[model samples]
Target: DSNNDLNDSEQEMVDIEYMGNNNDTDSLGEYDDTEVNVAGNESDDNDKLSETFDSLDEEQLLFDNGDNDTDDDEFMDDWTTDVIQSDCEIVCEQNMILVVLKKCRGLISMIKRSTILTLYFDAQRKRFKKALNLCYDVKSRWNSTYCMVNSFIVLREIIENLFSNKHQLHITQQQVKKLTNFELTSADWHVLLVLFSILKPFYLVTTAMSGRQYPSIGLAYYLLARLRNFLQQHNKKESLLEKRLKQLLLKKFLNYFDDENEQMELIMLHAYFDPAGFAALTEIERRSVEQTIKKSVADQASHSSISVANTLSITTTTANSENKPNANRNVKRNAMNLFNEFVGDIQYGENRENESKRAAIINEFYQYRKYVIEFNEKHEPDAGSVIVFWRTYGETFSILKGIAKKMLSTPATSVPSESCFSTSSALARKERARLSGEHPCSSVFLKDKIKL
Candidate 1:
């Protein structure tokens, strides 16, 4: 009905133009006054009608004319240019998109939001659906996948809001079906795999924790079995064999080895013989092993050395025992010589005001001198006794000496495990240049890599 009305309106405008040209206004003006006046009114009405029709024509011209071949070309050119310009803008602003992605990376919820926004902007409805489905799959496996799931829902809502009123622009189910069937590119698949890799350790941790008894050794065995199965499925025979050897070595150490208490030795053995098998140890166990090793070293050093004292002694020989006076005089002279030498080397003091402190110092020196004298007296007959003492007590003395040597050689005390944790933290935040102070669920995914 509207089409017919439009056609009739167009036809009426054409007829009015034809009649105006045929009936000259000048000739009509020269006729009788009554006739002239009526013709003048008709001309005025025609002029007003012509203006209205011109306006109508302008409005109709806004819609592309299907019948005109030339107009079709122009319409297509405009549409193509608009599309190309829009696509170019999208391409040009790709760096901005990357920046946004990086900025939103810290928080899991933010990452999810940004991903949805990117999908919406790209108009990838099918890809969006597939992403949502992936999130659902993850959630089905574990409810913690809610972050990704909520992101997908938010994206869907955004799409609906943007196109709800524009029926022609709406994303259809057919388009979504087509997109859902689209195969992921190799790079996309790799990214998904990396994400899965990140999640797997967390899954293992949760699974282990959920059990009635903490079966750490069993969990390790189960993990090893799973890895073997995966390797076999992938036809990785060499890797599977290597892993199997490591597991066997681990079983031998855990089941048959007697050094359970020597945790550092055990850790060293694991590092040397069964690198993969040591994953069975819990966090607490690992820490305990490290502390035990340090303490053992300290205790061994403490127990190894004997405390000894330094002393000096003197002896005198007398000649002519029958000549009592001369012999006595010679003995007295020898004793005097020894006393003078001893008094010159040793100093004893007393302070009336701080008598206790002075006495303590004197007593310590006296005890040391007495031990030295006794030791010298006992060994005076044997020249080889010094060598014998050194050889016999060498190990004990070396152990004592090692205490100071070790203290000096060791670097400033710092937890290497804690340093590793800080490094891991830095790696996690590299995608996010600034801290939002929000915790990420993906942090759990990094636990395996951060074991002490």
Candidate 2:
């Protein structure tokens, strides 16, 4: 009876969920099989779908709700229907903007147009002497895209007026026909300018991050933090588009940073250990980094102890001593007791180590800061010279020197590797194609050693 009651209650709940509070007998009837039948034969389903599609009219196919207040005539004029002569091309209207820009790419290739623009600029050199020259973007260099867009924006007025002299510019009849629908307007230029401004900082950031001479690892967290802050600041910008772009960029950066932070604990340790970078971190952050380093040291010491114990046990067996079993057991017990003592010693040593490390960190930090004050330092210490300082004065601050050496030895970016690849590519060019096989390695070594 209990099970039956439970079943009835479940059935009533299911009915309530699906049927709601319906009072009509027709609504209470079983649901029709008119809904898509996934279990039906594939061919029959396809036929039914095709029939349904055939029944759809132009009105039914369109999704326009007639709420848009944009002037249809002005929109039609802006986006020419030369490519597809249809009034129903509004679905891909957003994409049509990019399509127009892509078509305008050919305008950059016309020699006559280029010559005229150069001549015009030369004639008006007094007023627009600093005007940027027209340039095309290279596929291999993304920075060139910004340069291209910026140049276009700088010469927007001249370009717009250039259309009046289209015939004198020697634009052929076919070229004119092709470029008819691809003309950029004042509003388009404004949008391009906004985009270029948004991307300007990224170009600068890329150049900064690619620095080969500096200890970029120490600057990594600082640079990324600044970029995050910059993006957040832009999130408060007036333009909704700019704000949305910044939000997306910030989200992506946060996700990347969260992932990299886990992998760069050692890098942060090295950063904290850097005297030049010492001032950049707060006291709390410095303490956290010191604790992380201490934990890593403890882990290494533990592993080493375990390996040493195993080696000693193996050596004892190999010696084949003629000691009695009780004596052997006693030795074993003594060894076990010694191990326990060693563990206790490690625990006690850690407390002392913590105190000593804390003192050392504070002393180095203050000493460096004081030295900078005495010298009236303008810039931080030379990043490239850090390793040299460690090598020369390593005896004075042995622990810090070791840390500096480790940090300096590690390349902060894959730029060196990329530079090598670029060198190899240069060596393998059409004229020097066979040179790569001869002495590419030697060439790279020489190239790296030569101080420009």
Candidate 3:
């Protein structure tokens, strides 16, 4: 009864000018205080209340459903929640929501999520449920949290039923009262839908990068670029909650793809080498990457040639120093001339070889690009390994193959290495275990390398 009265009062306040003007208050107070509350003036008060309600109807007509203010005001009313007017306040509120989400991923809270999952999965087994199972989230994984939230959205009807049929669950009246907010309204669901849309791309990238068998680093640049583009595009169109989420995600994305970082070069090189990734990149990006690799290859070659020449000169000087000075001066001079001629020939041959290789590499790059583009245009995108593609064509493009080998060697993530260590730790978990250190190391190696 008290709750009903509270609702009625709140409804009435919606039409009331509770935010009274100071200037009007003095004019209104000029009237006798006793006259305002008299029985004779009761009709006047009722008329004023009716006029306020009439004005509210007019104001409500001005608010389109599409407007942010109208939607958020209705959303707040539905949830019995407060409106956050300032962008800063909204952002702070979103941050608090994120913190709450993290808390919800803790042990006890996860048990509740797991309960919902069990209910869904069991009901499906019983042929009574048509929805997917709710996923449990780990505190360390944002992807897992996204999955859980997504699952909740997908199976919202079933979850809503759980709270509705609280009697069946034997929930106490006090418990129901305390957990009332957990019953998500349509407005809450809409907010969650927005959140899911924003996080789905990030979830995809996380899944892609977590691969064990394939090269993930190659897709890193593409994925980051896609996410940045997605956030930028949606930042303006999104609601306050979604805008806050995009801002947070964009900041993180920019940090990961920072231009000054050494890893950026490594990622770009890997992406260039990956056939699928190369196809994904724009023409400009592909050209830039190719130029960078070519320059790097040339610098390496120059350095190796200089080192070889230095070593040869050092050997020649040592030999010349060991021989008698005057006795074999003429012989030494002749030997020096012959050595100089040999060195000149070697340098000339190397220069020619290097020039030919550089030309071949440049030509091969264009051919590869053209072939890949035409092939993609003619065919649907495949999810097969880029390493496999390069290996298949290794002989055809020898110089490109070399670059592929170098780039493909770079790991997309350190997960595999971390996993190996985790496996080793698991092997040593038994107290007073008699296993040798080498045995655990060997087991981890064979587990990863062994093909079934």
Q: Which candidate number has the best TM-score?
A: 3
Clash total of candidate 1? 5
Q: Residue by residue across 235-255, what tens digits does model 1's lDDT show?
A: 343343334433433443444
Each prediction's TM-score against the native?
A: 0.20, 0.53, 0.59
Location of the lowest summed lDDT over 10 successive residues in candidate 2:
12-21
The prediction achieving the highest lDDT against the true structure is 3
User: Which segments of candidate 3 are over 4 A away from where they belong?
Assistant: 1-127, 130-136, 167-169, 234-248, 314-354, 378-385, 417-452
lDDT of 2 by residue, 1-452 (tens): 54344323322211111121223223322222112233455465345434434432311212121112112211122333323334453334335435534534544433212222233333332233333455555433446667667766766665665555444332235445534544676666655766677668777766665766555466555555557677889534357656665675576667656457666565566566444555556677777886775565556656665676668767876666544455565554568787876774344544565567667756755554454343325445445534544444457664555555666555567885678788778866854555656566655566677798
Off by over 4 Å in 2: 1-106, 109-142, 154-158, 235-240, 259-270, 273-285, 303-396, 420-452
Name the lDDT of candidate 1.
0.34
Q: How close is candidate 2 to the true structure, as a TM-score?
A: 0.53
The whole-model C-alpha lDDT of candidate 2 against the native structure comes to 0.50
* TM-score sort, best first: 3, 2, 1
The true-structure Cα RMSD of candidate 2 reads 24.5
